[model samples]
Target: MPFRSPYPDVEIPDVTLYDLLFTSLTEEDLERPLTIDGSSGAETSYAELRDQVNAIAGALAARGVGQGDVVALHSPNSPAFVATFHGILRAGGTATTVGAMATGKEIATQLEDSGARLLMTVSPLLDAVREAAALVGLADDKIIVLDGADAFESLTDLIAENRPAPEVSVDPSTDLAVLPYSSGTTGRPKGVMLTHRNLVANVAQAAELLGVRRDDNLLAVLPFYHIYGMTVLLNLAILKRASLVTMPRFDLPEFLRIIQDRRCNFVFIAPPIAVALAKHPLVDEFDLSVVSSVFSGGAPLDGEVGGAVARRLGCSVRQGYGMTEMSPVSQLIPAGRDDIPLASVGVTVPNMECMLQDPATREEIPVPESGVSAPGELCCKGPNVMPGYLNNPEATSLTIDDDGWLHTGDIGTVSAEGVVTLIDRLKELIKYKGYQVAPAELESTLLTHELIADAAVIAGYDTEGEEVPKAFVVLQEGAQLTEQEVMDFVAARVAPYKKVRQVVMIEAIPKSASGKILRKELRGA
Candidate 1:
């Protein structure tokens, strides 16, 4: 289907992502006020945000963070972090997001990889940030310290004293805006480079799909470092002029408190948060009658749990799907289709094209016209896709072809109704006795049992070097399910080879900040 934007062809920003917001923000919008909270709330009208952007841009330029230079932010989801991204863009430099939980060694590697000359980190992390900075041999003048280090004063102070950076004309299509990292089957994180045009398009595309209103109150527990939160909630909030409520960490009781307190209408929740809302007892204590919808992403959401949450909240529980390399959104569940199959990830976003392919040959397969079809790889191409992975030519070449299609390593098919149901991952799918099995299927089925709380599935090899399905189960607090009983439960629902031959009851499974289970860790262990 052709994209139907009321503002279609309204012209994406002619500048960088930060510059876009700086120039397009209006005084009227600012007057309504925007609040970003980390330690506490900082209220700014759009006008103030724009003005500060200009000042920071100037300060950065004065300090030599000019065009093409990469500046890395190692801070959490704070106002400074958001401002720094725009500031770098306005100064004609590219901003890079560093995982806040990254170890000093990992931080050093990314800084070295991106050739980052400047780093912004909160005070408490100064020691780690300094060590990383030293590894790259960054100078004092290049560090824009926020809160943690006493080396540089507050960004507000510097911006207040500096003249606005000289505005330079830039073509959005060519200027790199942000660098976020994504890992492939190799489990190595590569920098995903998104240009100004890419980020702007994703934000607009998100607003189109999600349909934000000025009055919508969004609860943002998702980290800004992750593309999902950065694009869908943080950036889109500004684009749509909606109010955003944020928390640093996911605390179930406190999370419920904020929603009940703010009457938050829109929610950008990850899979883990969805799990809590669906099964955690704290959910019953709070009244979420005001929530309008919740978008779950960053990992596979079990269909059964997601639907139940929607019913409990009396709201639409939708899923928006993407990776860091796609400016974060390629498909979103349409508003009125909340009642569609709970497992489906929704249709391709408007202006985006999707195809299923044979993973080995990369051949496109026809979309299924009826019920569940044979699974294939998901491939996508759109303006919202990232240009390339930063400086990793080999990785970029493999991820995006010369023809411009981005190969998603997921295995799934699009149904006739245009709904997408994930079948398996190309890397995680288990081949057992000449048959294919999806770990997610076994995991999802395991989660549905009243006793099971968390589950991860992997392929176990036998003495003959043959593969069999294995499940690692995490039971809810004060609950336990034995291995044989759990295996029998999954065996009854799935095929013979797909049945769990081994079941291990784990206390907990580690997860990334974005809510993806650390499958690689499980395999290594």
Candidate 2:
């Protein structure tokens, strides 16, 4: 039998993303700071954000971008990103957010795959954006530089038009809102099709659990392109009417500076940042006493690391578990619950059902009467779950089953009290500093090298105990390549996080009869 969420279900509104977030704002909420740009100390109040969103939506509508259209947002965390993202959704266009660190080729692949009609990016990334836009046949006029650039239209120009936002009808249950790419089970990245209801339901399910107060200053260091940051940091904050202090990127001194200067009370971090907070000497230099809680996600947070940070900062430290296909949050340690184990991802959110099933036998593993249940794939069914992957029904069928349970390729055990603890991953994807690094994507890139005959990649632990992509390469006859050379070659081609960290020269890459790389054999070796 499936284990249901202990909390009572929350009512999810039947409305579009814009209406769900913007419509409920009161006069006091409108006057509050919605987004604060950490770099420039510029703030966008709720009223200003709404106006900017409307202006951008109106301009986008004027350009014929409406229902069923896709616009790719490629930029770091900023006030403009928040407005433009909502603007796209308000205009009934699906927003496909691309990572700021993505290479031109990577961006181009996403642009083409998502069928994005327009590209929005910052001036600093104009070179890569131009390359990607050109590859996808996007004309110069199709690109909207968020920050002003030479020979390009800026967000300021759009707002200057002062056109009224078109009244667009959206079916929340069916209309796509955001298309975030994820490497599900095993493969290169595919866009996860999250509907307006998917996101709205997730926010409603997680709102009480997250405990983000309206007065809380939430730090937004995590990249908003990823679902964890998109839903949790951006959407959830906006819905709750909290003040968001945006960090463009992670810099130790700068991150601490913003928290200290802005007096941010809550922070959402990945495991890597938690590690730094736990042991880094620089952390002691800043006064982080204002932080009431620190929530970690994207990758597993070590119990000791969480404990260390909790002790060091004197704040509540918690973690959660989910994927892009599930609006990125299935289980979270409810706010103010210090009783739950730090290693556990806590109980399932409201309106969700979870089950443990043996991967090999496909037998349901019932919850143990006492202690913890046996490790199995943690499958979940919920309104927050994505309907399917974009344009890939086969992949969708493989992920979400006939009965609606989405097989989250993670091995976890649930306690009798409903506390869930993750053990290991059954998937082939690597979590490097909380970023998904697909092995197949790296292997294909490696095979493209002239001297590389074959390659296989697997999750390997670094000296710091962080998971990284370690590649096993079979060079061509009489060819030689250094580990750094291989790493450098991949570094030049892919994002910095996806670069092959460790390379092992091998005679052959082990494979099964079907020619699939035996990743388990590599992991074992």
Candidate 3:
């Protein structure tokens, strides 16, 4: 039997992403500042954003972009990104958001895979964009720069055309709204086809739990290209009528300064930022008294780190769990709920059904009557789940089952109280002498060490040619510790099999834009 969300289900509107977020705006709502550039302190009012969206859509439509067409948006977080994203959807064109840090080959791969007809990017990234555009045989006319570049039309040029957005009939249930590529940490990047309903349903499902109000100013430090930021920070904030202070990239001093300067009340971050907030000395330099809540996602946040942040900032620190395939959020610690354990991802959002099944036996692991259930692959079924992976039915079939359950490829347990605790990725677990050792469990233990600033754990073969837990550690600034000392620390905290058998001190852990450890890169190295 599957466990349903503890919260009451909310009604999801049958409408396009554009209509769901913009249609109900009143005159007063239009006057509100929706997007603020943290770097330059530039602002975009709801009215200006809407007008820009309309003009961009009209320009794209004039270039033959419409239903069933794909347009790639490759840019960092900016006020212009917000308008261009919605503008692509408004034209009934699926927006395929590419990571800003993606290499030319990676960007080209996404452009070719998504069959993107047009490429939208900024001047700073033109070199990579040009390489990608050329590889995909995209003409110069098909490339639009958000900020002006030589020989390329800018966002202002399109908006200045002053054309009205063409009205297009959209079937919210079936029309693909945005196609964000999966992180591709474990495998090749695949386009996750999300419909308008998928995005709208997730926003509605998460509305109450997130509790982002119109008066709140959300710090958009997380990249908007990632689903975590795209849905949670970008879409949800807009739907709630809150303002977003956009940051192009994460810079600790600047991130703290913006929070203090903008008086941003809500902050959405990844585990890496949480580590900085809890441990970085620069954090003490900023007066972040205005921030009321800090939410973390993209990767699992350690309980001890989360607690440290909550105590230091005097704000609620919570964590959520989701993937790009699920519109990015399915479980989150609801706002104002302190009773839920910091280690847990909290109850599932409304309209979601979750289950745990043994990876080897494929037997259902029922929720324990008393304490936490046995760990298994956490599977979810909900309206927010993607219908399938774009152009990859075999891969989709492998991920989502016949009964609609999306196998998350994550190992976790469900408590009798409905709280979900993630263990680790099923494929990332280390097998030592028939025992499964979760790297996340060991990594979390390593983070508690005072000398360790950040860490990542993976499976490595020992002298005996047996798989063992290996740790890549980043020591705190000016701190030094031997490999033996690191191993001994984790050995005392975790089980013998879960101990760090090997330790390699590195300057920093390679991470994705969303802050997930790039284990594949480490493995390749």
Candidate 4:
């Protein structure tokens, strides 16, 4: 039996995300601050933001950016970045956000895959963005730098053009709004096609589940490029008309200072940040009395860590679970609900159904009677679930079944009250400090080395309790190579987060008859 959401279903507005977010704001509310720059302390009012979004949308239209066109945005969290993202949506175009830290090749791959017609970035990332733009065949004019970089069209120029925003009608349910890449069940990165309705539905669903106070201010330290921040901080904060303090990067001192200065009431974070808040010595130095709750996602939050943070801060500490494909939020701890299980990821949000099924038998698993919960593969069905993956129907079909159920590829258990606790991930991808690192991608890269006969990658924890990708390599007979050499080779090619931190020389890699790596056996070894 599917465990439905305990909360009653909320209404999802049938409109563009921009329309859904702005429709409720009054003229008086426009002058109110919507976002604040954590570094500079600059504020962008709702009215100012809306005007900028309109102007940029007009400029995009003049540049022939029609509906369904993809515009790739590569920048850290900033007020300008926020405007550009919504401007693309305002122009009826899809925004494909790339991580600011991504390498030129990495950005180029996403550019090519998403078929982005334009690239918007900051000057700091210009060198890498330029290389990616060139590799992806994006013309110089099509690449707009946020801060004026010599000769290239700047965001200032676009806003100056001030053409009319294009009027493109869209099917709310089917039209793609944001195309953020996610490594789903299988590890290769693919675009998750989120429709306007999907975003609106999730915002509405979360609004019903979370306790979002109008007076609460949010601390936005998470990267906006990631779905968690994009939805929770950027979109949802705007939906609730909450003031958001944006941080470009996470620094412990700076993070605490902002909380002190801004009196930030709600903090959305990953497990790593939660760990820092729990154990960091500087936490006691700051005045964090105003903070109401700390919410952790992206990775599992240990019960001990959650409890410690709560004890230290004298505030609610909670965890939630979702992937990029689920508009990034399926379950979250309620705003003021202190009674929810410490380690549990909370109940499914409104209008969603979740289930636990035996992986091998494909049978529905019941809640365990032994006090301890029985773990099974977690699956879900909801309006918030993605329509499908972009340009990858095979993966879409595999992930979402004919019955509209999304197989989460995670091992978890649900209580009779609908609370969820994740046990382990069944996917072969490694979670290195909250970033997805595919073992298959690394294995393929390892095979390119002439000295390597075979390779397999698995995740393991270091001394600090952070997940690290550990690679096992079978070298060619008598071929000389050190473990450092293996790690360095992959480090130079891949992103910093995806680099292989540990390597073990192995005689041979165990595999199934069909040539699938037996990762479980290697993990055991």
- Stretches off by above 4 angstroms in model 2 are 183-186, 428-525
lDDT of 1 by residue, 113-186 (tens): 88888887777777787788777787776776666346566676657776687667667897788888774334
Q: lDDT per residue, candidate 2, 144-241, as tens digits?
A: 89889989999999999998999898899999999988732255789999999999999999998999999989999988888888999899999889
Provide the TM-score for each candidate, comma-separated.
0.94, 0.83, 0.99, 0.82
Ranked candidates (TM-score, high to low): 3, 1, 2, 4
By lDDT, who's the top model here? 3
- The digit string of per-residue lDDT tens for model 4 on 321-422 reads 888889978898887677789778898899888888888798888765445457788999888889888889999999998888899888888876778877
The digit string of per-residue lDDT tens for model 3 on 12-79 reads 99999899999999999999999998988888999999999999999989989989799999999999
Query: What stretches of model 4 exceed 4 Å from their correct place?
Result: 183-186, 367-373, 428-525
Question: Total clashing residue pairs per candidate?
Answer: 3, 0, 0, 0
lDDT of model 1, residue 249: 73
**How big is the RMSD of model 3?**
0.9
Best by TM-score, which number?
A: 3
Give the poorly placed runs of model 1, Cα more than 4 Å off: 1-15, 38-42, 368-373
RMSD in order of candidates: 2.6, 10.0, 0.9, 10.3
